[model samples]
Target: MRRLFILLLLVLSCSSKDTLPDITVKDIEGREVKLSDYKGKKTVIYVWSRTCAGHTEDLKKLSRLVNEYPDYRIISYAVAMDIKDVQQSYQQIGIKPNFITLIDPSVKFNDYFPITFLPSTYLFDSKGKLIASYAGLPEHL
Candidate 1:
């Protein structure tokens, strides 16, 4: 039974990873948005916190990517953060991000993503399958 259970766990783990879960996160306006909403559209799901300096840098790069890749449907999630508190700081720095950056205060997606090692970004194809996951900011188009 133990061997069978282990085997089952491995299979499930491998299987689940292939398809990104349909998780619900928030937008800058505090509205609930689900991952399924972006299905069939190439998505860039990023988990970030307002406090991380790395994340701050990443956001600058992300804005550039949005302008470069307007053809692709990019969704940059500002998870585990509140944009209101830092909006002035974000703007005072002259950083205007074009992509939709969501705010996830509920920590709902924490189970699937790591909060501490944030600024983690995920790329999904038009079909909503996770194609790439970058730990920091992405510089490439």
Candidate 2:
């Protein structure tokens, strides 16, 4: 019975790690928004850094997905030094994202999402459960 209890606890802990936490992050305009607010829609979070090259191309691909998958809540989560850095990067790339863009100065979202690399993509279901994750831009979302 004790071993069964331990196994159940381990399962719960592992499963919880796969779900998106209800944490608050700031938008590009510095407005606070809760990640949980997007729970009802399929979410695609593209994590990138301004210093990382080649993200602009991936961003373009994601832009296409934004229009093709209207039902998906696509977000460009920028882990930059500041909002100005992210803005400058966008200007350099000459592309303004059509999807939602959020800023993470200190990378607090890493605690929940565990971003090991720049320009990573995380796909979550409507219920906030992580469905798939890619280290870099995939050929298709």
TM-score, each model? 0.73, 0.84
Candidate 2 residue spans exceeding 4 A from truth: 1-16
- Candidate 2, residues 84-106: lDDT per residue as tens digits? 88778888888887889888787
Ten-residue stretch with the least lDDT total in model 1: 14-23
Count backbone overlaps in model 1. Answer: 1
Candidate 2 versus the native: TM-score? 0.84
Top-lDDT structure, candidate number: 2
Candidate 1 colliding pairs = 40-126
